[model samples]
Target: MSIWEFANPRKFTALSLKILPTLVGLSAVLVLGGLIWGFAFTPNADKFESTVKIIYVHVPSALMAINGWLMMLVCSLIWLVRRHHVSALAARAAAPVGVVMTVIALFTGAVWGQPMWGTWWVWDPRLTSFLILFLFYLGYMALWAAIEDTETAADLTSILCLVGSVFALLSRYAVNFWNQGLHQGTSIPVATGGRTVADVYFLPLVVAMAGFFVLFVALVLARTVTLIRERRLAVLDAQEARA
Candidate 1:
């Protein structure tokens, strides 16, 4: 009944495997549909013109990149407090996904920014913070790969994740912190009940963000399942060698 019950590797693996197919299918449909609608059907914006279309990919990915690190931060805290191997492994699994999302965001942002900002890159507060978050992701993954002991690796990486979260938080809020940045305000300001983007672009952008979130869940679950199996296999191999 409790959500924590699913923290057990066997239970987690079984449940994740069961839902993964649905998640995968839904993500693909939503992502493709949203992209088609946003890119093909929507008219150009008054200021940015066609370049504004990249929001379908850029905004979602940027949101995911920040939130993915937050997810890892939560997993890391769970691992630290509960000493759950699954939590640690989940954090590890999410790093690559987070990093890839960060890359896509950075690249797409550059593509979108060139025309608007008159340059490919700038040391804007938000952009700099996001870049720091990406570096932290790389460092976390490398720490996991470098340590031989699984528990030690998990402990270290969890700590690193905790530290990296500062950058993640900054990445999401740096634009607000510094008004001088070239980066504009949020496109979909749900909190304020007003949207800067028009309805045509807003609808598809929402769908794309939803799709990205679902895709992230599916990927993290799949990777965690694989890690659980690999850990079991390693234990079996160790036992056989001992025998």
Candidate 2:
């Protein structure tokens, strides 16, 4: 079946209910395991020492912040084109989570940067554009809140999301565009020309990234289910009032 079939509240709710417990359980296990491995077992970096461990949280959170926005963009597009209520609700449900992830990334990055970069803040292209992304998220949410009519809010937010896509792209590619900052060049362990971070350190970073992805998925699914239920209730209440 097409992806849209799953957008039905009843179908979505049933699927969510079936998967929720498993998702929650796995998320808790993975996050805790990842933290234990990252903090206790991972060796300190020769350059940054234990401070580098922050990568476990900072990198994954930053990546998820971007992924969450992309998901919202897709949902917004679907809502605008199909006038699907669930699509709009999913987009709304994703906004706060995206914002929270962005905040975590920025906060953790600042903490990690202080000892390494000697400053907690910078006007570098990547950092500055990420800040702008946070602002866009806030504005999008506020626009939705300010409007009483759901349809109008969806349309306006969709437009804002599309516009904000440019900034998101800039945020990702800022380092390449500007060629500035103390941020180290990208390298993956086991890849050609990769940084030779110790395996003790590398494993935990991988686990942490997996854990965060699980947590993000669980949050989105739970929030979408809640939004679907609330919308269903509202529709029922409206019909009763009409009767």
Candidate 3:
């Protein structure tokens, strides 16, 4: 009935077991297929040329990079408000994925930028905020690791998430507020894209985005299950000690 029913460990575990395999298989197929299509089938753009192929991975990685942090923020809020263990663990599960995606985005952006911008890095507003977001991910995870009490770790990490959210929001919109960056304007919407890219590129990019999204979800769910099982084992151990 209530969506919270899934928060129960048994329910979550059972449901996740059924769905995760499908998600994983679908993601692998889509990601691999999309990437192959983009690289092998799609022609080079007149502007970006061969470098345009990177968008298959770059755009999807960037999308997941932002969405992963947003997912953590939402999960953290739910943990704080509703005291859901799943919510807290879900936030924890998301952090490493977010960090990896952020790094991938930055790395790919640098690779893409070198030929275009003639530089590997810059302090442009968008880039700076994105770097800040990566730092926040590290700090959030580090703070969680430092705290010994699970509940305390969750509470502290949740607060850290709230603080870092300001930078995350800035990272998303900084391109709009300060358009002076070396990076080009948004282009995914096709309409807002200024007709810059060809339609042939859109289909693979869409598939790649969908694949990465599903992969991100699968990873989070898998990690959450591991965390929940670890927590359950700890509880059992404590009970055994008392017995």
Candidate 4:
């Protein structure tokens, strides 16, 4: 089958339906195990102590917050280049999930920061950029809702996503160029070389991050399927009205 064939709403919806159960079930297991290990089983850190436990949820949410926008950027590019309706709707479906992830990151950061940074919030580059990322998600969703025409809404939001992605990348890499803030430098590296976090904590953190990824995928699949159904209903309603 062609790439565009998968872009069909009905086809994509059917595919998402078949895969969602595994995604949901496995993610739930991983998240439960990670939480159990991170909070209850693992020994307290030598430095941060019990407070370090927050990293389990915080790091995973932060990772997803950045990646979710990147996923939307890719979907927006696909929609812009190939005019794929499924891609557009998928991007839309992922927006609120991204928002929730961003919120969790910010909230957890504040919780972790109070004892570490001595403040609930700061003007740190990383923190500020994350706030901007949250705003971008809101604006993207608002633009989509305000426009009545799906195609036109998709077009405008795709442009917004392409533009907002520049800032999102900046948020991720800001610490490298700019002054490192009260926020700790990178703790987790994907390849597991030159690691900062201990293996015990890192391992569960990895599992938690993987669970978050799977959870995001499940949400996007279910939400995109809903959007596709709504689109079909709108089309049929239009046809019946004309008939």
TM-scores vs. true structure, each candidate? 0.98, 0.93, 0.96, 0.96
lDDT by residue (15-124, candidate 1, tens digit) is 99899999999999989988888999999988888987899999999999999999999999999999999999999999999999999999999988888899999998
Q: Which residue pairs does candidate 1 place in steric collision?
A: none
**Which candidate leads the pack in lDDT?**
1
For all candidates in order, the CA lDDT equals 0.92, 0.86, 0.90, 0.90
TM-score of 2: 0.93
Q: Give the TM-score of candidate 3.
A: 0.96
Q: Which lDDT tens digits does candidate 2 get at residues 1-243?
A: 888787788888898889989989998888889988888777788888889779888877887888888888999999998888888888898899899999999999899989889999988888888899999999999999999999999999999999988778777767666788766544453446466666777778778878888888888889999988887899999999999
| lDDT tens readout by residue for model 3, 1-243 | 999999898999898999999999999998998899999999988888999999998889988988898899999999999999899999999999989999999999999989988999989988898899999999999998999999999999999999998888888778777968777656764446555556799888888889999999999999999999999999999999999
Lowest-sum lDDT 10-residue window in model 2: 184-193
- The whole-model C-alpha lDDT of candidate 4 against the native structure comes to 0.90
- Location of the lowest summed lDDT over 10 successive residues in candidate 3: 188-197
**Best-to-worst lDDT order:** 1, 3, 4, 2
Candidate 4 structure quality by residue, lDDT tens digits, 1-243: 776778977788778889999999999998888878899878888878899899989988988999999999999999999888999999999999999999999999999999887899998888888899899999999999999999999999999998888778878888768876776668754455667777888888888888899999999999999998998898899999999
Which sequence of candidate numbers ranks them by TM-score, best first? 1, 4, 3, 2
Q: Indicate which candidate wins on TM-score.
A: 1
Which structure is stronger by TM-score: 2 or 4? Answer: 4
Residue 107 local lDDT, model 2? 99
Judged by lDDT relative to the true structure, which candidate is superior, 3 or 4?
3
Q: Report lDDT (Cα) of residue 20, candidate 2.
A: 87
